[model samples]
Target: MVYYVAHRLFSAHDRALGARVAEHLAAEAGADAVFLPFCDTDEEDLVADVKGLRLYQLDTRRLGGLTGMIALLHGPSLDDGVCMEVGYAAALGVPVTILTTDFQTYDRAGRVPAWQFPDPLIEAVAHTVVRGSTLGPRTAAANRFAAFADRNESQIDAAVCHGVDALLHAPAPVRPAPKEQRGVYIEASPYTPDSGLLAAARSSGRPAHVSRRFTAGDPLGAAVEDWNLAAASCALVADVSGPETPPGAAILIGAAAARRQRVIAYQPRPAYTHAPGREPNWRNLMIQYASDLHATTLSDVTAGLES
Candidate 1:
């Protein structure tokens, strides 16, 4: 069976862990082939494309053809790219197994409770979550990773294999295509009921669904509902005009793109910079590439409706 293994590839340590997982999946977990994004870069033309559009397309196309996906959920905060892949895979009805070996926790003495690892939205869409050793020092980075891997390698291998086997043997479900309705789903932070974009979509005679309207008061439930709305809509207009792209919006954008829906990302201005003379943060490459249109104004966002 072929599997797409998603993991952070920016560091040597990250790459090593990815390689180890891919190797175990192949040699021991009954996988015939494992696609590693970092190692599978054959798109010479898109190699230096700064916008990252072609590269994202290439990866998603490859991922859609895979049997399943295994994503590594490591680091203090989960990698954004990996989360996007998980969302995309989930939207396609592809089984996803999350492997997290990081032993970090965010619980505080007197603060609102927080998840020990991944956000609940991520867990909600995953088929399996294979958690590794939670018995390691919080610091001493390199040595800690080595020791953690040494202790949890066998455990992880067994869990991952079991999950893959179950998923492969499970009966496939029929996934109907989205209804041919020209409705627009708007994903925005601090959702406004009468936002100009929503108004514009309605004025254009397209039925519009605001993400906040689907809130279920529970994170997981809300995420699932919002995702469903995004899937059902013909287009998704995301307002990313903030310091950072909202995680939920990013996930929706990825899912929408995976379904080949029109994704219009609106970032009215450059992201806030902490100090003057410092470079301003831009929208993430994943969002830039996944979106069919990158709108810098409300009018640009509205123009997408006509297309």
Candidate 2:
């Protein structure tokens, strides 16, 4: 069975760890068992272009066809792209196995809540979570990962193999018909402007559900509610024109794309303040790649609603 391995690829250490994990999995499974995005040559040309939309399309399309997905959720903060991939896999009913080596606790007040690890939305969707610990600096963690994998090989193997069995046995989920699905789900950071997108969606004669309204109060419950709205909606319009890319937006975008729902990533312009020597209009490649359309204006987003 072929599996898609998702992890951070920006840093040298991240790449090393990802490569090692893929190699180990292949050695245990088969040479062709794993599909690593960084190693794929299908989008080699698009990799050099900053505005390469096809690269994202090709990756997500390949992901949709995979049997299962294994995601590495390491580092001080979980990689945003990996989080998006997890959401996408979950939404598509593709069994997911999350392997985390980061031992740092994120719980406040030293008390662990039900949603103690990472974001509640992510934890809620994962089929299995395998935890491992690595000592020493972040730079050395990758080199030491093979030992951790060896120690936890049985657990990891069970999780991955179980996914295939569960997928084969589980009944396919029911999806709403095009006419039955009505609303447009609007997702945006509290710091960004969404009123325009909201207005545009409403003007198109479709019901608009704002994510902020549904994602308040209890964290776990809110995450469930937010996910429900996203799954039920006919389309998702997300505004990422804020100072930083909202983690929640990234999750929703991935989930929406997985459902084959229309997704419009709204970023009117580079709204971030960059330090000297840094690119001004930089945005997360995953967010842009997963979206059906990259909208620069309310009209552009509105056009996507009809498409």
Candidate 3:
């Protein structure tokens, strides 16, 4: 089974260790895994690494990947991207196992709904349910084990074990699409310095239809960009949290809505602010795409859409 590990990429601390944790789990399970941060998908100007069956197929042999997913819920408020990924994975019928940090309290009110997806909804979709980060280290009692490493290693290792276990145990998903068919389309803005928005979109666990994946520069001419946005299932227009919207982003949103594709707009938290007397124009057209006009979080927009 192939394993996809999804988590927030914006870290104020070390990420290598967490990545290693995911790698270790994949190793222990003897499974193939890909961490989004590590993949370089800009080959051939097509961004073809992730092949979807009309945009929702999470795994396909053509892409040489697995259909099973393991999502890491690091905190009480699930990362908007992570939440989207989990929902996307589930939407496509891929078996998902949630490995969360907040599982200990078993506080459904605090941890699960933070997903903004109704209770028993996320739970019903997951194959393996685990709370802790580590199941325990892949070590022997006779071997030397450091206390510090053990604490961390166990959490990550457990996550993998549970994920693999869940995947192996769940019913297999269907793969009837013809070779090279695509599903679940999206267009991402040119990446900016702050990862908060891009990370949220890419890690939403679904593949994007349009990509600026390899570089910050524009990958296509206006005609091609206009066509891609027109063809996409949805356009995820993300940008830095500010009053002024970027031109490229505005174009995607406008074109996407014009095409009647679902558009999910995310301006990072401090979602939007305007002069006291001024109307928040940021919400003007974007709100038309949102379920709740006043909603500020990414999870709100993606919650029911995926599940």
Error (Å) of candidate 3 at residue 154 is 2.9
The residue pairs that clash in candidate 1, if any, are none
Worst 10 residues of 1 by lDDT: 272-281
Number of the candidate with higher lDDT, 1 or 3:
1
> Model 1: runs farther than 4 Å from truth?
29-32, 42-51, 102-119, 136-177, 190-200, 213-215, 241-244, 271-284
Q: Please, what is the whole-model Cα lDDT of each candidate in the order they appear?
A: 0.66, 0.67, 0.44
**Alpha carbon lDDT of residue 182, candidate 1?**
61
Q: Which pairs of residues have clashing backbones in candidate 2?
A: none
Report the CA-based lDDT of candidate 1 relative to the real structure. 0.66
- Greater lDDT among 2 and 3 belongs to 2
Per-model TM-score, in order, reads 0.73, 0.71, 0.43
Q: State candidate 3's TM-score.
A: 0.43
210-293, model 1: which lDDT tens digit per residue? 775223445556656777778889999877654456555666777887788888877766663321222233565566677888
- On residues 174-214, what C-alpha lDDT tens digit does candidate 2 reach at each position? 33343355699888555654457889888777899877432
Q: Which 10 residues in a row give candidate 2 its minimum summed lDDT?
A: 272-281
When sorted by TM-score, best at the front, the candidate numbers are 1, 2, 3
